[model samples]
Target: MHDAATPSRSQPITAGVLTALVGFTSSFAVVLAGLTAVGASPAQAASGLLVLCVAQALGMLWMSRRHRIPLSLAWSTPGAALLAGTGVPDGGWPAAVGAFVVVGLLILLTALWPHLGDLIAMIPAPIAQAMLAGVLLSLCLAPVRAVVDDPWVIAPVILTWLALVRFAPRLAVPAAFVVALVVIVIWTAGHGGPTGDWLPRIEGTVPAFEVGALIGIALPLYVVTMASQNVPGVAVMASYGYQVPWRETMTVTGLGTVAGAFAGGHAVNLAAITAAISAGPDAGPDPKRRWIAAETAAWSYLVLAVASVALTTLAVSGPPGVVETVAGLALLGTLGASLSAAVSATEGREAAVVTFVVAASGVSVAGIGAAFWALVAGLVTAAVLRRR
Candidate 1:
């Protein structure tokens, strides 16, 4: 585990490839759903996915090697949840794209100002997790809604997900995604003359800035990505004894997000859950060697980027409830973790509960969504009720 190394150094197949595979397969459906939820067309969605992968791959590889740590990168799933849960602005998808740019800039700002990270860190963990819980609650209900409305199409997907969750936990979401696609293909084939084009189509959208979208979408996206994704990403590395140059990595993630959003992608940030897979001892006996695991992720992500775009096409073209159903199944574990974290602290339990309820309600006032209000309400409550 030397700080300095040479090109002749070899990487292991076991750690590197497995981490990449797990990261990609586990969450790509949710990424697709998030893009679509914000009104991205199929082509635009593919562009976003492709851009996100390539940017994260390049950024993560460079950072990990520079620091000699497994500095993995991932898109913000919770930010996607926020997008999925929010209503689009009058300015349309272009406006949303504009908001994504704002989010990127804000991330970059936070990186430069350590005080901003400190403010987010000051928020109770419970409240932050509660806000995320609220954002995700609706998507979590999607599977149930699909079952009640169309059991036949939705049943197979749910059953497959459940079976995999029980028998092979890590593969559950990816298998569910596969089941949804197969079900869509079979149903389409049975009903009519071959479904529409299945090939990936990449399209670009020129962003148009809108004030409403900046407040409603961009602000919340920045807050959640910083609090839920990047902050935790830092903690995960540190938990495994890695010294993260927080400012440098955030600059990379922030810049990466800006680059990706130009092609309609949402926010890219530190990999929280997946970081452990690469940073842990299992990545290799020598911790320095683990950055190879992340470097492999970079290469694998580029390879998977092609398939990711194709899968996005399939998910968007699938049956009505099918895509959301797959997305819900994919995020189930994340939802559980958020819910658990939301209640882990007793002092802020009531405030966090308020935050969760308001966020889950999807209330919108003056074009601003519940995620913001939930945070406000919870913070005020926590302040007022202190010592009670």
Candidate 2:
């Protein structure tokens, strides 16, 4: 007979595996889209996914084991959305890689210089959330657009997503991805399956800095990642009675991002939504034993990494909008959450709305993306309103 007082390994293990599965499936499409949007070839994008998985996996294992807590990590999905919006920069793919490296350095600086993190916190929450919502807007609309473009392929994917959202919210996006995979396979079989290296491989990029990319891609990527992932991640862990070692985490993730940049990854940070899955009471009755869940999740990410090459091949070679439809469905929840938070405070509503408008406009000026302009516009509006 099992003792009631003893913690069950299976509980944390199950929670951990689910966390990794949900985390990867839900946002990997966004990651691929982001990398490709910013000038990566299909091979480079696949490398990005592979390296990101490895970086976050190793980081999670280190953090969880060192802290003895379920310190979950994730790729920055909001940052990916920002990339999808930004498009190719002045120097193209190399420039984008440089921006990624710069973002990593910024994160590292945030760890070394406390005031850096403080400055990020100083950015009004409404503006930040609004910017995230704006970045997510177009991607979230892919399903709606896809319905017009290819109704048959998208319908089953959407139905699967909707069904899972109603019955098993946690599994919703992953199930949708599976449906998308099935559709891709069938479509590929009809049109001659995609030809590519089935095994995982890395395509390295030498970073090249440009003013436009630094301002447009790197700065906004840092802000979106820090605001959406790291800050919320700390809060989530706090809710579960675990205090994350902020500096240590930042250091690990920062270095990881720098390393991954060479292999085409955008950014890696602490997990927000999936953290709850591994840290919550569902993982185990004993708080001390919960670190096992994070460790398990790290391993699970490694396992998921094995499929990156195959998935990337299908996504790149499959019919147009099929993978994007799944990406759109995956981001729907995040879009809703960001929109809600954007206008939650009445005092900042106008500024937030301005930020959203500029960002969603998808306008670029003087080589700078709308995300940078959104911040500028929102801040100016907030200051003017304060004066009045």
TM-score of each: 0.91, 0.98
Query: Least lDDT summed over 10 consecutive residues: which range in candidate 1?
Result: 3-12
Off by over 4 Å in 2: 3-7
Provide the overall lDDT of each model, using Cα atoms, as 2-decimal numbers.
Answer: 0.82, 0.92
Report the C-alpha lDDT of model 1 over 115-148, residue by residue, as the tens digit.
8778877888888889889989899899999999
Query: Candidate 2 on 161-279: residue-level lDDT in tens?
Result: 99999999988999989888899899989998887767899999999999999999999999999999999999999999999999999999999999999999999999999999999
Which regions of candidate 1 are displaced past 4 Å?
Answer: 1-11, 191-202
**How far does residue 367 in candidate 2 sit from its true spot (Å)?**
1.1
- Clashing residue pairs in all predictions, respectively, total 0, 0
True-structure lDDT of candidate 2: 0.92
